[model samples]
Target: IAHGEIFLTTGGRSMDRRQIWSAMKRLCQKAGVAPSKVFPHNLRHLFATAYYRVYHDIVKLADMLGHSSIETTRIYLIESGAEHQRQLERLGLVS
Candidate 1:
């Protein structure tokens, strides 16, 4: 891997955006997963959500994501309705 390169081709050259997306799509297909739901940008959302769950620090996450405003990071942390319902269920207040 070269400096600042997240992924590289077999020839040791840096992988461009299209190549990364294509690679991800092919891997998803091989794994029997829906390629439509998996992509490089979606992985950023997944990572931000999981990291926020563990740390609960939006400011740091914003910095890590290179966002000048924490509000932008908040968009990445939005929980799905299913997850929100699960949390409400765990509260035992609606039983």
Candidate 2:
């Protein structure tokens, strides 16, 4: 299978959101992490946020997230509040 191809085959059917969430919860429990802190949707958010942080390229991010508009990606993925404040501080712009 390729990178994006689905691997599991249950009667040649695709896994739904509940199955994915349950798997994530089980994995998180095994790893000694709170399941609430790392749900499946949270993983998607983390991916978008991390990619944006590393590249700062909204166009690429929008494409990766399958978003039709960069504006939607920006609203969902842009770091603000405490995270934004910390980033500014790290860059010596908050002194």
Candidate 3:
């Protein structure tokens, strides 16, 4: 039923990065998105960044992201460019 279950049924086969990229491209095309603008890893990055922004709990983010080190999870915070915009807005620098 799940993808992991289907993988097991198919002799535990694993797809290489090229195959994964191809599949992602097809899906992105179907969704009317430019492949260049839709990175597969960005979804994970967005999830981690949003979770940390809402909760501000690094330990919980590390667990959710399956990161062995909290330092690894910190990398996702770098993608939060909107946080800077929010700070500037709060300071009345921008309406």
Candidate 4:
């Protein structure tokens, strides 16, 4: 990795993935969030969901995310039941 790309370091060495994950968990705990709910992979899903919501272009999203199959990218876009309900309500089909 390039020096400019290194964000976290210890004793002149860059932090590994495990160290980054642990640091994120600790930061979340300090912020009154559940450490168990803080994970590195979840950020990828969050980014995918938010990107898809904004652009509504699954093919481009799949390519940007480096997914070989659009099906794999679809997994990242799953929404919560409450969010789905809110979207349906926005349609204003019912009184």
lDDT of 1 by residue, 1-95 (tens): 33377788999889988999999999999999998898899988988999999999999999989899999999998888999999999999998
Each prediction's TM-score versus the true structure: 0.87, 0.74, 0.60, 0.75
Model 2 — which ten-residue stretch has the worst lDDT?
Answer: 1-10
Ranking by lDDT: 1, 4, 2, 3
Write model 3 residue lDDT over 1-95, tens digit each, in one string.
52342212245666655666677788999999998976657767888878888999999999977899999998888745697788778899666
Best by TM-score: 1
Q: In model 2, how many backbone clashes occur?
A: 0
**Which sequence of candidate numbers ranks them by TM-score, best first?**
1, 4, 2, 3
Better of 1 and 2 by lDDT: 1
Tens digits of per-residue lDDT, candidate 2, 11-95, equal 7667777888888889999999987787777877888888888998989889877899989998867666999788778999556
What TM-score does prediction 1 earn? Answer: 0.87
Worst 10 residues of 1 by lDDT: 1-10
lDDT of 1 at 71: 94
For each candidate in the order shown, give its overall lDDT on alpha carbons.
Answer: 0.92, 0.80, 0.76, 0.85
Candidate 4 error regions (>4 Å): 1-15
Clashing residue pairs for model 2: none
Candidate 2, overall lDDT? 0.80
